[model samples]
Target: MTSLRRRLLILVAAVLLLAGLATGVVLHAAARADRANRPQSGGPAVSAGTVTLGRKGRLMFLNAATGPHRTAVASVPATDPRGGRTASGLTCARFYAAAGTGVCLQSNPGVLKQSTRALLLDSDLRTLRTFPLAGTPSRARVSPSGRFAAWTVFVSGESYSSAFFSTRTSILDTRTMRLTPSLETFSVVKDGKPYHASDINFWGVTFASDDDTFYATLNTGNRTYLARGSLSRRTVTTLAQNVECPSLSPDGTRVAFKKRVLSGAALWHEYVLDLSTLHETALAERHSVDDQAVWLDNRTVAYALPANGEVGSSDLWRVPADGTGTPRLLIAGASSPAPL
Candidate 1:
């Protein structure tokens, strides 16, 4: 009977110790999150102002600096990218704008689970329409004419680095309010033969100047391909292998994309592909880029890379598209770059 009492006492002590450890972990996590929300020292000065996509000679991006304006839509003069920023009061997890239309993907906590949605914005950054999203926003784009918009979300795992994950990509015709809920329903032609697969996943859509044509990453059977899709026909055809997140050039002659360097690894090198020649030119940026690139112009491309020594922050960098010049920092504490 004495031995039984001793065992019970030991179990009680162990339970108390575990409770204390769990409390400590929760407190530490709360402290870290609090620090992230607070404004950091030497951060950029941001003030609320009107941000219009119609305003020419400007560049817009989601501000990543630690402060109240973090994740807000902010803009700087294209002539001076590092100049003072004017921020719109709106916030988003991912954003893209073209010709006067903007797509903002937002998320908020809910009673049961996290709720996500996409907001269609006008040139003045006002919400014109809202659509429910299935998961966390990954990439967003708008047609150059502002008639169409597309967004991708992670339906399963959070990051592309994960070996097993799924994504859902949607396209919207803002003019007619027509929406394609999932790209997977579209017919796929692989290597001049009709292909169908249960494991197919699509993401990182980039629209061409022509409203009917688009480019996106199509992954299936452990391989990724650059797919040229048609919105009118509801079909996509594989153009090249090992291409992810293809961004069509302004001139429409080449596509800037991230090419995976090692199989089953997240490492990637940015490359420009000539559509006519099917040739790829490796860009000068040596870092492993994980974000979909945006063309500053026909000659240059910009992308986001994780900030050095800063957690949960990213910076925008630009490199020449022809694989000539070195990579340069275009904007500090910024992501989702949109040139107006």
Candidate 2:
């Protein structure tokens, strides 16, 4: 064959190979998405039903099972977590509830950027109000009285493990509909003195029942500290270092948080801190937990861990607050455990 013809044939073959690979990739992606929307053979039974935040003796979570209900708010009897799940049509990236109020963070893709918002929900899961979010949602919490709500979002980088990132945390008063656009505007008292830094970032807010006080993770100077915040005073005081995502107990005596095990790394271990003595007790989970824990009761704390052999999913696990018992699986395909 002529040299020009030979080269032409080779180029044509290369284009065909590339076309075949592109087709395969598109097909595979479609198949994966279809599977995600269909119920799995052995997955837990889920059905559409009413989910109320005020329902007593129930446990609510974000369902992660492969089915139509995936990512929806689901509830089961706290006594029987493995029983059939009742799914609420509402979907959220992160969710938390207390009393009769709920805060749901939702994200949707946009042509120019990602659109994010926080929905204030009533007991019946109705959208009472919607607030625009600055970025992707990370953590959410409501005051035990259901009068206050808070949410955290990443303003720059997506992952907390990233070397550098910025977050915007906001608080809302449900009664008056007043909003605190950013917690950074509050005064910071680090180690009892006034503190200020250009790189300070705050996230993972957990509210106290009183509605005036809350706890959150404050990051500055390459270290993370547990900051006790007061909404009435508009101030935050650093309590301890190396603490992130602090969840207050029902009695408000202890905080369950994830402690970084190493510097400059994302690894963390679950721990409970006594507010009176400032003592820390590491839990028995052993695995790295990268979530803000929820106190199932005064004695037990639950958090989400990446599901075994599953991508983009997590399972709810609980451990004793005293740091004595082994970690037990509370829900197979769940995240964001909230007890009502």
Candidate 3:
């Protein structure tokens, strides 16, 4: 009987030890993720400065010296280059620039259960603020006036399980210091009527010059639509169908977006939406681009696409904004093109 008791005690002790070890492992992983977090980057002191990161391929800068390849892109006065400078300790999975402001989504350098944080930076690459995000990072954008910033994250319990997968997109008005954690809170309108649904999700918000008005994509009922939203009125209206990740042109008269087409081979085709006529034209880009198309100028659209279906092998490519010329490779091993 004593031997039996000893055996039982040993078994229970072993189980407890194993459980403790598992807990320690999880805690260690969390710590590793936290190590990658940057509440703020290490940089020189600045009361107020511009982001000086020079054009590093993906992050583009426009100035007087920049000989813009396309006609639609505005020509800047030839001046000293302002981009391509490196930001110390500031690494981003995705980055965007507009109106002298920069937004970056920094992801945990881990393979499993990773997290992301959205960071706002000034023109000098100084950290303005940081917002803890809900899931894995996807997209980030700043308003033309640098008044508003927005981002998207994809959360999943399991990488391959759609049932436990979802996305969160949020916006912050830096000028007013207000935050809209979910666009779902805004009033929804469709076809000139109030629209309501249980599964409405919004992402890829692109602000107009007014900065109070914006465009984004809404997905529900197994379909997506382009939506126009107002920051002042706090409302969104459906504008057109089959549009996702809309990037407004520099002129704000056209939007470059990804549209699903009939061909089953390529998942999406790059297209341009004329805001005045509400008409969309398919671009010459034939690859399946699943990104917000950045306007290099009023007439040139650039976006990222995976090379040869390889996941991490994405490269930047541009097509004519008018959908006339063929798509051409712009940058290799680099993406998320943001003008400086």
Best by lDDT: 2
- For candidate 3, lDDT tens digit of each residue in 255-297? 8888877533337788999998998788888877888889877
lDDT of 1 by residue, 154-271 (tens): 9999988898899999999999999999999999999999999999999999888888999999999989999999999999999999999889998888999999998888899999
Lowest-lDDT window of 10 residues in candidate 3?
64-73
Clash tally, candidates in order: 0, 0, 17
Q: Which should have the higher TM-score, number 2 or number 3?
A: 2
TM-score of each: 0.91, 0.91, 0.75
Error of 3 at 28 (Å): 15
In angstroms, the error of model 1 at 176 is 1.0
